[model samples]
Target chain A: MADPDSNDTVISGVAPGISRSAPQSKEEVIVISHLYKSFGSNRVLQDFNLTLYKGQNIVVLGKSGSGKSVLIKCIIGLLRPDAGEIFVFGKNVPELNHFALDELRARIGFLFQSNALYDSMTVRDNLEFPLRRHWIQVTQAQVNDMVMEALEDVGLAHTVDMMPVELSGGMRKRIALARTLILKPDIILYDEPTTGLDPITGKEIIDLIVEIQNKYNTASLIISHDMNCVRLASDLVAVLIEGKCYALDTYDRLKSSTDPNVKPFFEQ
Target chain B: MATDTTLKKFLDETGRIAVFTGRFLNEWFRPRYEISEFFRQCYIIGYKSLPLIGLTGFIIGLVMTMQLRPSMVNYGVESQIPAIVGISIIREIGPIITALIFAGKIGSSIGAELGSMKVTEQIDAMEVSGTNPFKYLVVSRVLATTFMLPVLVLLSDCIALYGSYLGVNIKGITSWSLFWNKVFTNLIYADIFPAFIKTFFFGFIVGIIGCYKGYHSSKGTEGVGRSANSSVVVSSVLIFITDLLVVQVTDLIGYG
Candidate 1:
């Protein structure tokens, strides 16, 4: 069992099975070690290790089907890892009971790949969803205020009553970001945030992500195949290949590195 | 070779049905509620299904009355046409046919919508948000279907009785007052209550199975089609199974 209160500090003491040294300074918020997962015969993740610190934007770069989404899904408990451990906020994810897992989840936000906005809900209703579910004691005025504030944060305040279908792809992404912000989470996970947008809109989304992270001081883990996004959004970059992380470094360092496999991906 | 193929098909169908039922039961009690999503599902699963159910009920009544009239006339029981068709429609035909129609329309929609949501990672978004997607998606749908099916069945029964009257008057002289008098006179509480009661379960099965298929659907467009097809097929089959049990129980309790 892992202590829920000391979730951030526990990751530094645990290594990725073979390494004994800590990956970061004392401010680490997530630590994953020897994590393994499989779906039928497909082994998606194998003995993967990662450590994310507070306010760090860790971009996971991988080709499609390289299990970047699975890694995040495991951390969020949507998909269970076969072996090893995940500690978020110092709580070992697998050991935490359902109640604790839920409590932990409430403090985290996720921006889905497709924006995942409920097609049936208006933008206002979509933003209101998490608030209403978890914060029942909040007054209607407070809910309204918060929803508007979140929408304003994403610059979609005027599209409150519009359904998801009515919005452009970029607007939908912003609306999703607004929905993520409504929870006031300490951490936000983005799955391919700019996969389908025009380059200009994609850049705008990247800037919005940075803005949100800086303003909220929320740690972000972004999974994307978009190299430009990886270059712009990452404080540290991890390239996932062959079920394990090959490199975790700054953009300039990874770009200049002589490692054969890591070099081609960064160069391209 | 033919027997082997048939056996394999039977096993496949059986396995699918079991999995569908099991998943629905499992997801029913799971926590997490998406209220806005649920209401939207209700509108789709319940409200939108009305026109189709209504139309089917009307046709069933008209056809049933027309078919039975000449036979009753041959037996010199022409006066019993409305009474017989009315009892048949209210007691069984109306609820069952409407439910089958409901299963086809609403069940398929719930399946496809949820399937697409699952594929697109929307359900995943809800789960990661600390919201219980199961409670929000599955339970709300089940609740809506449970409540709405009865209303739909009642409306269907009423519309069907009207259609039966129209059929009765097509070839013969019958006043609306006298026609209804004959129909209602034979229909006791026993004939109506059991039939009405069964529809709630019918709705529950349809909603639960449709939602179960959609919510657990695999990734991509292909999964969406599988969900829709399974929802209709499974719900239609369950309606029959449920109708059979309801009939047996009604018989055991001496409803006839």
Candidate 2:
């Protein structure tokens, strides 16, 4: 049996610019410490700790059923952990009430694996939904400008009148991203940003992800298994194995490692 | 042991539904209500359902009058046809049938719509976007159904009465005034008010059940279908059960 690879440095606590103790800096957007979650007998996440700093893209890479999605859900306050504190903007996620959570969510964007665009609503309505929902008072002209700007960010300005069902898969994904961008969230959580598309489309999405990060300077926590997404988009890669952060290091460093557990992923 | 577990599941579901209802009530009066979406839902759920309800009510009234004419003639109460049919239709058949039709149409639509949204992760997207989905989707729908059913029922009752008039005219000459006078004479406040009141509850039950089934839908695409199917069946059964309770209450209050 191979020992779990704990030799790699944990980027969240050990990264040069960030302090290990008392994470009170405005730079740290999300700090998930000692997170443990399970459904029934299946322990999905155990002692998972990660800190996302401002303007960083952290890709959590894992195999299928490795609790990657669960981790993202926990960070977004969709699923409460059995034991842990997920501090987002100095407020614990699980501890916040509904209104407070809503307030926090306005500042945090989430790109779902499914894109999750509203099929019944047109593209313009889809983008306007969050603005109207959060009660962000703006003139119609301002809303139109904001909507167009978000669409322009994703290079889909012409799709405003189109329904989601009318768009192709990659187009729909862009629309979903545009909707997320409309809010101008400080932190964005992406769940499998390039799952169901072809290589070219997937690469295009990855490029869009980088472009958005560069433009907005938002902290992004992306959960993915796609190696292309991992290699291209990650500022740092956190390897999740057996419900724990087995290795947290750069993609190149982990790829060059000879450790049996981490070696197989690189070999693939 | 099996029975105990089944009973426990039943209680758990009931409690969960109650909580869902409570949340709706709590969120209803909050700021940033989706008034535009509410009207849009009303248009879809209520206005679009008018033709179906009207057609069904008309057919019921026509067939019922034709079927009852023979019995009335044999009993020498043929002239009382308008009063008898009007009383039966207005007091019970009209509202119940209209509500059932509304339930089958709007209830299933709401269930399938929300179920698909849940499966597709649209609801989750709304949540992460700082949108109140329960308020935007569920409350608008519930309010639309609750307020619109009574209006639909009233319209259906009128169409049904008109159909009954056409049915009556097929046999002999009956003036419009005579027919309407007979109907008004037999129809009392007790019968009209209680029946009207019950349809609101019927609408409420349909909307809530559909919302509950759809909002909590799991297991992907299969779950969406199951949510729609179960929403129809559950709302139908609950409509009857609630109608029974309403009848009991109204009777106790001397409405019957």
Candidate 3:
């Protein structure tokens, strides 16, 4: 059992046994090592480790309750892992205090399993929330431009004044992506972005995910069991089995993997 | 061991609530106040609750006055009705009734609103977006309730007095001026000030407890309803407990 109070460390390169090729750029954005999290007797994440490079998308594919959401929450500082270092931008996430974690979150966008848009606020207000929160110095005119630009990025510029409830499921997802994009964060964490949408809408969301990654050159960590999403969006796929990164490989290579634990995901 | 576990849970919950309160205090004085949202909450939590509080106050005053008339007549002090009603309404009944009404209306609203936000992950979204939900959601609301309750209580007290005047006029003849004169002649600084001061505490309790419940809401949509229900119940109980303490302190200090 790992010590619950262990401090985080900065490390280079992927851990041993993660055989996928590293990104061309050596700049690592987020690194998780020897992470352990548990709830009572149920140990959710045990000795899990992964390294996310800049401008890369690593989809952690897992079954429901496999701790994928826990991983994302820990990265974004929503949950504190019992042990291990989650280093994001040179600061350890669990070790960082509230103010520090909040500051870090500004630079990292997180899209929830739900769209999580303020239903009470207009679409314009949802997009403006991040800008006003982080850059209070920005003028109203500049904010309008940024809001429109983000909306345009998601191809929902017309829906800016509309309430979140008025939008369809796909539109809500797009608007949420736009809201996350308004901040122009360096990293974005998507928790099952394609879930609960029709196949067409899901594909559209995946396309948008890829497009945003290219346009912003942002490193994204997507947690999903959606095989289509894993196939389309992941620059590399990390198979999370029983609270550990069981395998790390490209989509094609993982599809051909012979291991039973890794085979089931590819078959789907 | 079961007792120990329950005690620990209670202590932990208390500590968490205290921390939540401390965090609000720390972030309160920081810059970039959400002025528009604060005013909106005041409009919603304060201005919107006046009708309900006023109606309750009116009924209480009228009923109290009518019931007291027979007793006063028995004691041969029927003329003292306005003075007695005025002191009771101003010193205690007015604030307590208005607070209970405010708690039901505003406390549940705050809890449900924030709890829905919590269950939907809107609060998390605000946090990840670099907004302080505590400052944006909690501070403005707590401040609004703290400031707004006293104003509502004051307004309710006046309305209750008018109701009492009407109640007095129903069975007997007393001029409006004379009724008001009788009511005011007994009203004093000690009675008004202590009652008025305690209302701020009432408002604070309602606001903080509501926010605390909603902000920490868990389980799901069911949690939202629980948060709203528990906020009203807890705040109402706390209001009475606070009133009891306030009365004791005031009495000890010679205000009684």
Candidate 4:
């Protein structure tokens, strides 16, 4: 197995300034320790521990059915783990009451694998949904302004009135991204954002993910099977296999890793 | 041993249904409304189902008029045939038949769409995005169904009566004015209100059950099919159960 702390070194390469010194602050944004989750007899995640700082992009890589998506779901309080603790912004997820959970959710954003845009709603309405539901007190003009801004960021400013069905696959993903950015969430979780897209679109999506993260200075947890995306977007990489995560320093380090499972993944 | 197996199967099925229902209700009230998704659902559930409801309504009216013609003629009351068919079509048949068709089409569609989304990790996407999929998807759908179904039933009732009028005039001579007057005289506020009210419940059941089945669908292709099938069957059965209870209550209060 690769050293769990190896990925700490990779972080140094990307942001040299943040790497030079250790033990600077005690403000951990998200902390998952000893997490174990299962569906029936199938154990998907086990004893997974990770701590995320604010404004960091952590890409999770694993084969199909490796429980990478499950970890992100657990952090967002969507899927409760059978055992372990997930603390977001110093508050334990499981311990929080319903209102607290809602509050926690408001602070994070998610981009889905299939871009689960409500098929019935137009692009404009899709963006408005979260804002309205969160009761963000903005005037109609402000809402319109924000929606346009978000759409512009994704290069879909002209698609405001169009429905998801009318958009191509790449366009739908952009619209989903625009919707994700509408709330200006502090934390963003993406599940297979580049999956099923052409390589050009996939690269474009990866660039957008990086651009968005940098723009908002937000923490991101991305789950993907594409190694290229994992390498491009990650400040830290965690390879999940057999319900356990082997944290790595970088894609290069993971590729060169001597772990039997890690070797085959790179060779392929 | 066989009896015990049957009992166990019953308990297991009931438990699954109960859990599904509970989760749906829990998610239904939580904040986050998907207005676009809801409107899309309304288009499918309300507008799309109109053609089927209309066809069935027309057939129901035509058949009732034709069947009642002979019985009324034997009693020298052939002139009363239009009124009898009109009352039956509006008061009872229109709402129930429309609801059943709505359940078959809209209920199953909601169930399958949501179910597939759940299995495919789309719902999870909403949660991570700080959006409540439940409020956005489920509540809006339930609300749309609640309001739209009553309107559909009302439309179906009107169309059905027109169909009946046409059927009555095929062989016998009756003025449109006299036909409507007779139909309206036999009709009371009592009959219209209860029937209309029941449709809202029918819509609620269809929306809730379809959502419930889809939301809890297991992660696979098979889960989608199961969700769609269960939604139609369960909603259809619930509509009948609710109708029976409503009818009995109305009768007890002397509305019948």
Candidate 5:
């Protein structure tokens, strides 16, 4: 994203009433510079850099096994990059101690590929896990309200009493998202949010993601290969190729890009 | 080369277990303890294992008495059967058998549960949810097993004694009070205390190894199955080894 001017143009028809933020309000929440990470001889990320601004969704598009998950993991301080700086909220993520990392994690919601809802717990308990674990002080009434509100956000308020196993695939993903929403995170990282769902369910999830983004106005770094998700939810599309952000632009602009590396994503 | 690889893997696993133990020790004493989860684990691990332990104990006691009857009659020492069975059960068989059963059941359960959680990213999700999975899962479970096994053994010993009483009257008449009196007259603290204390070691070995195998499980579904299988095998082996070591120590301490 060398040209700051390119991001000002919004892609329409994907999400209506999305309320995409003004360019002047772009505050950098996550900044990665010259990030390099590798495992054994496999280089997963190399000199990769990205910046996520507040109230914007940046979709990192990549093929499977192309370091998309690794990139998000590094951003969330789950994995330490081999080299370079990851400035998350002005703190070097890799440099922070355990306590600091945990504090940072509190503000970032990560929706895993598998949904990762606690199987042993009812939907209500799963949603309350973050709030209870973080030692958040709120009245029981307030907690109930918060849980209900998060469930309503994903439109699964009735499933709170049911266990995760009883829910369908899309329902479970929605419940997981509700759990993530319980924290009211400043940033949400979606790791292939639409990976396993059917096409219609995937669209609904993408719409819900956009709705959440618009409703909360939180920054999001979505890693996905799903073109619909990239097209609909992304305010800025970061094309990841060979362990780097190969191209960064609006989805429409990236769709029309002539570069061999960036054309396949938009070829549909 | 194969032997070398196997040895290296074993040493690596040993080192990893040591480090995991050290980590457990470090985090267990830290603040923000998971008290509720700990108690929940205690109930599940301790209270839930009662039925199986009791049934097994009863069978073992009945079988011991019946088997000893033949030998006792041949030596013309048939009247001493209760005392002999009581001494042997409390001193050795009771604790070891209960522990082996505990290892088989609890070890595999923990391994499979945690391994599934690991593979499905639930453990990682726990971390991201602002909870230390180690404290919530591993520490709670390990401490549960540590405290639960001894309690189970104590109860099992009692049940086995009752079963022995039933077995005694199967052939000949003996009053309940008389049977108990004869059994207790020969029993001493030396026979009981060492056996009771060794079970804590047995419990700790089963727990730590089970947790270690599950927590570090990889390779997805196959890895989870391997974790469950090996948790049982490793814990059972370690239980015997720990019993041997603890017995040696007890003997040196004049409790033998």
Candidate 6:
């Protein structure tokens, strides 16, 4: 699989300096160990361990229904795990109170699979929502500037006044990305960033992911099964299987992996 | 065995609702009050519901007066129409009808709204955005419905009384002062205060039930529909049950 397959490595080639083979530094931004989560009898994550470093984009690659979303939710303290510790920035996520969690969340951005844009709000209002929500004290003019800058980051400055409903699927996704960027979160979580878009739009989103990572220099934990996204956006790939980190390695290394389970993911 | 499971489900739902209400009570009074969202909900839940509430109240009042006219006239006491209709509308009919209408409209919308938000991960988005979804969505809405229903009921009562006056004028020439005087004379503090006070409870029941159903909504689009449907049904039934309980209490306390 690692025979320099031109198609697989195409997106990576386009965005130079994106696909890193290893962590650049030892600054562990997120250290999750022995994380076990289950809903009733369905154990989604079992003994999951992965570490994210500063300025790294680690994509947790898993098939559909492999508990990728569950893993992200636990890190943000949205769903308390059955047994585990998710340490983001040295503080255990589960141990934090509501106020503490909110404080932590301000520094961590999450882009939902569905975009989760406020349907009732205009794009401008949607972008402005998090500013007022986190009680970030900024004047109206600064808020506008921040909103524009975030929109500019996604190359969707023209869509500032449009409603989410009016935007196409890709535009909505971009708007959602803009909202996530508005917070300037230290660690961003992308949940299926390329799932619903067309292949072309998906590639655009992947390129944006790489671009955003480069410009903002923020660490990211992206959850996806899309190989295109996997190739273009990941610094290191963490393969999730049967509620555990089956493999955590580079794309090229994993492509060449002879493990029966790990080989199938690369073949596709 | 089926009945046993059904009973268990009932108890479970009730317990869950109680817990949900407890959370709301605990969170609503704390800091970072969403004043703008609260007012926005008031505009949506309260102001927007006026026309329907008014129309229903007017129609019912007109119909009730016309229906009672023949019976009062049978005993040559047709002049008691205003007094009878007034007392009944204020004490029982007005509040219940307005509340049921409210349950149908606001309850379903709130359910559908929060249910959709839950399904779409917007609720989670709000949370990850560092804003409490319960505080921003549920509390503001519940408070809006609780405060606004009373005002809507008061307006509904007034509109309904005017309808009754129109209905009275349809049959005989009763002056506005005489009609209003007779209506007010028949209504005591016991009737007005208890009826008015009970609406706050009705509003709260509608708000809390709608919020509960929507906030906890599961599945997908179908779940959103179920949330909307169940919120209306549950709040409507609870309103009647609460009315029965309140009426019995008032009777025991000599307010009835």
Name the top lDDT candidate: 6
Q: Counting only residues 3 or more apart in sequence or on different chains, how many pairs clash (N, Cα, C under 3 Å) in candidate 5?
A: 0
lDDT of 4 by residue, B93-190 (tens): 89889999999888988899899888767777656545567786778888788888998999888888888888898888788899899899888888
Error of 2 at B234 (Å): 0.7
Ignoring the other chain, what TM-score does chain B have in each prediction? 0.87, 0.98, 0.96, 0.90, 0.98, 0.99
Each model's number of backbone clashes?
7, 0, 0, 7, 0, 0
Assess every candidate by TM-score.
0.87, 0.94, 0.90, 0.83, 0.95, 0.95
Better of 2 and 4 by lDDT: 2
Worst 10 residues of 4 chain A by lDDT: A15-24
List clashing residue pairs in candidate 5: none
> After aligning candidate 5 to the native by TM-score, how far in Å is the CA of B19 from where it should be?
1.1
**Tens digit of lDDT per residue, candidate 5, span B138-185?**
999999999999999999998998999999899988899999998999
The recovered share of true contacts, given per candidate in order, is 0.71, 0.76, 0.82, 0.50, 0.71, 0.84
Give the Å error, residue A159, model 4.
2.5
Better of 1 and 2 by TM-score: 2
lDDT of 4 at B50: 87
For all candidates, state DockQ relative to the true structure: 0.63, 0.68, 0.62, 0.47, 0.78, 0.88
Which clashing pairs does model 1 show? Answer: A7-A89, A7-A90, A7-A91, A8-A89, A8-A90, B32-B132, B34-B136
For each candidate in the order shown, give its overall lDDT on alpha carbons.
0.83, 0.88, 0.88, 0.82, 0.88, 0.90
Q: Lowest lDDT 10-mer window, candidate 2 chain B?
A: B124-133
After aligning candidate 4 to the native by TM-score, how far in Å is the CA of A237 from where it should be? 1.9
The DockQ value obtained for model 1 is: 0.63
Q: Could you give candidate 6's per-residue lDDT for residues A154-247 as a string of tens digits? A: 9999999998889999999999999999989889999999998899999999999888887878899999889989888887788888898877
Off by over 4 Å in 6: A1-23
Which ranges of candidate 1 are over 4 A from the true structure? A1-25, B1-44, B188-190, B248-256
Kindly list the per-residue Cα lDDT of model 3 for residues A1-268, writing each as its tens digit.
2222321111122222222232336688999999999999989999999998897888889889999999999999888899999999989999998778878888898888899999999999999988877755788899999999999999999998899999999999999999998888999999999989999999999988988887888999999888888887887788887898877777776677666677788786
Over the stretch A1-268, how does candidate 5's per-residue lDDT look in tens digits? 3333443222322222244532314578999999999999999999888888888788888888999999988888778899999998899999998788889998999999999999999999999889988878988899999999999999998998999999999999999999989999999999999999999999999999988887888889998888888888888888787888877777877777666677787887
Candidate 4 vs 5: which has more TM-score: 5
